[model samples]
Target: MSWQTWRTALISAAATALVVGLLTDTGQPTHPTTVAQASPPASGPGTNHAIDDPLTSERTRAWREDRFGMFIHFGVYSHLEGEYTRPDGTVCRDAEWIKRQCRIPQAEYERFAAEFNPAEFDAEAIARTAKEAGQRYIVITSKHHDGYALWPTKVNRWNLRDHSSFDKNRDILAELKAATERHGIKLGFYYSIWDWNDPDAVHPSTFGRYKERMYAQLKELVDNYQPSVFWFDGEWSTDRPSNPWLTQDGEALEAYVRTLDPKIVVNNRVGKRRLVDGDTGTPEQTIPAEPVSGQLWESCMTLNGSWGYAKWDNRWKSPADLTRNLISIAGRGGNYLLNVGPDARGRIPAESVDRLRAMGSWLVRNRQADAVHGAGTPGIVAEPDWGSVSRKGDTLYASVYRWPGAGGSLTLKALSGFDVRSARVLGSTQRVAVSRSGDTVTLTPSGAPTNDIATVIAIGVAPPAPAAIGTGTGLKAEFWANRKPGGTPTVTRTDPLVNYNWKYQGSPDPTILYSGFSGRWTGFVQPRFSERYTLTTLTSNTVRLWVDDKLVVDNWQDHGPLLSSVAVDLQAGKRHKIRLDFRKESNEAVAKLLWSSPNTPEQVIPTTQLYPA
Candidate 1:
């Protein structure tokens, strides 16, 4: 019924995994188990060590502790409806709105430099408002998919300096950087790896020769701005198949970036297979069951439906929803990057600001519990229930979603190891009765409370070393082809071009799938292990498994992406036959399937089997 009820029930079900190290003797508090040691990466600058480095961990901690940050998406595409236009008058629909709105040719789009004056832009005011809203960082889009550079660059003339009317001399980035620094707020820059204007970046024709100019401009941004974080996006370019950005050369690009600023944090989108530095962006509404140990992750979400300001988009999240999401992310050891789309004039919409302000007020009232370094308690469990709990160290804050008309006693299980010092409603300090028996703790209100929403119950525990927090673990599976024993198998995608017109076919959902336009291709697998196994496909498209049965993956909901996987146990030492059935749905472009295992390199699915599949 209520969100609190649903959250509690979901968390309770997921808590089974957590119950392993928690059960112990009744009188003494149980100490959490030691987390497993992390292995080193197969290849990279920080090889053979934990992937989560000090800088990354520190950043993650700061982010989690900070609890809130601002995201700004402003670029040439903000003005242009589609992505970009070609030299010819014919517009590329792939560019989305940028291509649709900017009917002008390259020459005319270039002249937009003069008309790009954002007279109402106020960097100081924006920074101040963010501070008042209790935000700790400001991430701005320095360059988006449209390839229009916001700051002046020596690598190319397609920048605000040469084209904009803002004194043609003043740099928006420089001003924003200075203002943010003055306000004691960290600044981050969003740089898109896919640039339509750069010949070397991604294009169908010029296969080799990635523009050195692009790297030069990247160096300029790092050297000049010295951003704390380099948020990258748009890696899914149209030219991926032939010029796969994840090649050795692409890895070199990321290494080059780190060389420029070793302290700078980079997101997964920087590399072809998301190998740069951190976790892929998780949407806001989703929460992982286990903490991803030894990895830096942040959930980037919009306050409303869109990341950028859309005049017609009015959907907004409520204050309770925002605060609850923030708590949920923190509980799972992740940061929340809340987005705010400024208008064409570069001012944050007033409505968005008001909502953030409301959230800030709530945070101020509960600063101690929600502070960055606060300990995370196991989530409150509910069974078709009515409330939730927030725990920090010895105290548990129980929030009753609704006051049961009959006023029954509140039951909290799995809390018997600690002593219940007292219970009190948050707004008032009045103590309530708390009783513990075995694994359950019960709390009863002294009288009917005045609150409309939930009430709090604080349970104190005997001080001990806080449970050692675990990062996360990984799951691996192996598959073999045609009962082959020790034979090399080729793994190739049915659609190798990523033409943006292909569809996936398989059973069981794949952990990873490739989707893009232009670079339509399939992955060919060579098995590393020789064993008999089952193959499952996880997709919504019509796919025929050529290996055994002309098994169909899915034939319905052909337009949207779906996940399916095939799993068959195999014996070591064998060669086998493995083939995928793939076809394209109308207007659907691009498809990819990956076969992976513990022996395979992380994030990479081997195309050719080393052994028989």
Candidate 2:
């Protein structure tokens, strides 16, 4: 589905769930009490514990290096081909959610399950296609929101082996697992939290039972296939009114999954896709406007208009558009998980295969695969007007999406004093003429771009060594017991940064309760370059910030993760007094202070730039 529709559904679902009960529980303990909770090395929020988890960091790092993956959305709905004909001679068009959208009765939906025979399903062919697409991993729908399992699940009979005419012994998941292993491609599962067919999941009274089976199914997946990633979805109350999938439930499930496989990387969809929920944020269908703050993210988009097979929806994005999107996402430090919906016969659409092959061919011909594998947001210079820039160590890969006319030049301005050592186009022997005028560098290519999709220009630059750890002592934080900080402080400490997510924790200090607390941070913010910087604050409650004794941001009202910013001019090698006052009114708390300029990427105010006042 499109991101706009998903977001609209989320709002409606959240409202409906909130109306039913925001924190409804089924009398089950939400904690993994048997397992010890790991603490992050720093004083970050409890939500960020997974980000700094020592046990799984290496695995997470490895997954991040993969960069690009394929998402397969295949299920019983594929048989409908995004259409359901009614007895009245009318038709309903919807993909994946055809049953729900068409108002098909439960009996009718179940009856169709028996005829869901995917005779052409070839797991090795699918894996080979992904390999040839230059994709490092594949996340297939083990079970979508329809609650039909692809494997021969022992938890219930609502699975391929038991319900469908497909060979009982030939499990699609198992085949894909072995095939992915053989192809050296990591495999992952996309499991839905909401089960439309499960009676226990739909009714509030039997929700606890559903949770038990869900845990069992997840464990079964882990023990049987040993997937590298768990991409979850359908956690909201979009159709079901009494959805009891709360954040605490997600927390418990995450803990349980960790016990099952400590190396598996999970997406934030495990808990409303919050920053504090899981290992990475799952941005569906649309790439984020910027790199997500304080969390790693991946953008999952479909090859066509729908994630599931849609016979009529043929609005396929061009190969150039897709490749440019991948480069844009990589430039923003995110992975791209492109989706392909197989037909009822289990054959991937020829359009998708052709596009995937084209992308793979381009990457191979241009030798740009290495440039995208572990690339991140460029730190040497600002994003240029011509294209996006991704950084891997000191090397910058500038991907030109819009090629300039013949004899035209590509210019990069507002650089951060990085000395350009060399410039060359990838997959070509032509040398790129590089000239620098102060902070601006102009690159004149020897010839036109190698490919019309995107031309990769490799720039080798030398950045200066970072400042020492003790260059700044950080900001002084004063915590108060009440919502107002006028009274005597309850505790005092030095906080490295103004980033916190106190969702499952008590007060900032041990002296106060979780809610109704306040904090004041005072420091001197030092910039690395002189420019007009946008100082941003993301908070779940009231906050006010002052720089150089001038109040720039005065969002002194309660809110939920609202981002507010104000531009302020600051000079390099100068200290500006920065003061932020925050109040946690109630419930889950979060606060983050970030800054970005023409030359700097959006990031948290570093410890080295924050000196105690």
Candidate 3:
């Protein structure tokens, strides 16, 4: 479906959760694990696990360990394959949601089901490719928003076996479930909570019966199909603009599904109002800046622009780019669910298979870094321009996407207090030169990378570096409690400046105003090297900042939650005076400072370089 359908359906809940950055290039859209070993680490509000239970949490950990998987967005829409023409003669982009976007009558949409004869579909072939691609699991659409079922459903006669040409030989879900089991790969089923095809799905009154039918269908799938994960969508399809009277009991339905198969991992879209808080956060087409440490999240992206088969769409990302994306997503400790759109023939596109095999080859060569367990969090060494860092145990895998130079040298900063024992390139026996100087480690490979996708250099070390805060002491502050920042002097104090998301019901200090307040801060900031630095500030009200008398950030507007930033060049070892003026217009006030540079990742400017002006 078009992203608009996704966004309008999900804008309310998804906007709050984190999305790992992966992009599906369809332009018109608004839309929208691991096996457990020991005690699994805590997950955020992304999963439905009752933290109170051990097995639930352990299942979640296992999901995280399965870092890579395949996402199949197949449906009757695949039959159209972007062949439908509009009045304007412009072909549609989102092949999956062609029915909704093009406003095809429900009857016409259903006809595609009869045309959808996936004779070439082989469950074993798909499973083998996914396994070879290093994917631990596979998620396929069982029933989409069109309400079409892939399995034999007593609730609806319009299912794969009865209506379509899919015979017992072409029963995909059953065969795939068995195939995946034989290959030791997990199987997931995608179910849309909303149904456009069900005739009784018109009003809230009719929704009850519709839901009953849905429950029956869901029960049948669980009782017989036995999927490991239940990926849900279209929960936002209730009582909104497009279909103003429609309703679905998303949460109740989810509860029922659990009674049948409680071990089934479900995505957050199972509920209407209470979204996310499900088993996993499914961020469609975008990878978040960093891992949501508290949440279980995955970035789902398309292989060639469209989610479903688009016969005309040829915009495919290079295997090199896709490989790097997999590493980046896994590095951040989030799962990567890449998609493939099958044709009417029920065959995965040749291009998609090639890309998956390329990734599989890379994973095979770098097996140590692609561990399903004990992987390190992302943000290792400020994300070198040459590539990224993925960790397994104490070894940091330098995934070199772009070789720094023929000289075979790369430097990593902020690796303090850790000793490097050895550095060797994976997939080859070549030893790399590893030297340390305090917090910096310089790696010199014997030569350039052999793999164009990614050549991993496993640098064995004694534990990894600690998470580094920004570089400077807290800024000096002056505050006026009852007034805005034109003049300030009611309070003055010192505190650490990193991670400054603050809230206070009463007084933060006796001297500073409890409600309306104005403040000014000044400090000296010096970079470790001569480079351009980007300074950022997120504030509730008006805020402006200057770097050495130059106004770098001017956000003095009566605004809500806002983030603003500016960039400036600075020489190393030379301290620059930084001044900030802030005014709290409301009862609650908060302000934070973040900075990034060639050597620094986006983090709060630390305390080591700060000095009172």
Q: Please give the distance, in angstroms, between residue 555's alpha carbon in candidate 2 and its true position after superposition.
A: 2.9
Q: Per-residue CA lDDT of candidate 3, range 367-466, in tens?
A: 7435333454533355677777866667677887777676657888753345778888877777688887866779988776777877788877764333
The global C-alpha lDDT for each of the candidates, from Candidate 1 onward, is: 0.49, 0.78, 0.66
lDDT of 2 by residue, 461-571 (tens): 877544334377689999888888887798888988787766645457655777578899998998877777889886777889999999988988787657788989888
RMSD of each: 18.0, 6.5, 12.2
Provide the TM-score for each candidate, comma-separated. Answer: 0.60, 0.82, 0.66
Best by lDDT: 2
Better of 1 and 3 by TM-score: 3
Highest TM-score: give the candidate number.
2
In the predicted model 2, the residue pairs found to clash are none
How big is the RMSD of model 1? Answer: 18.0
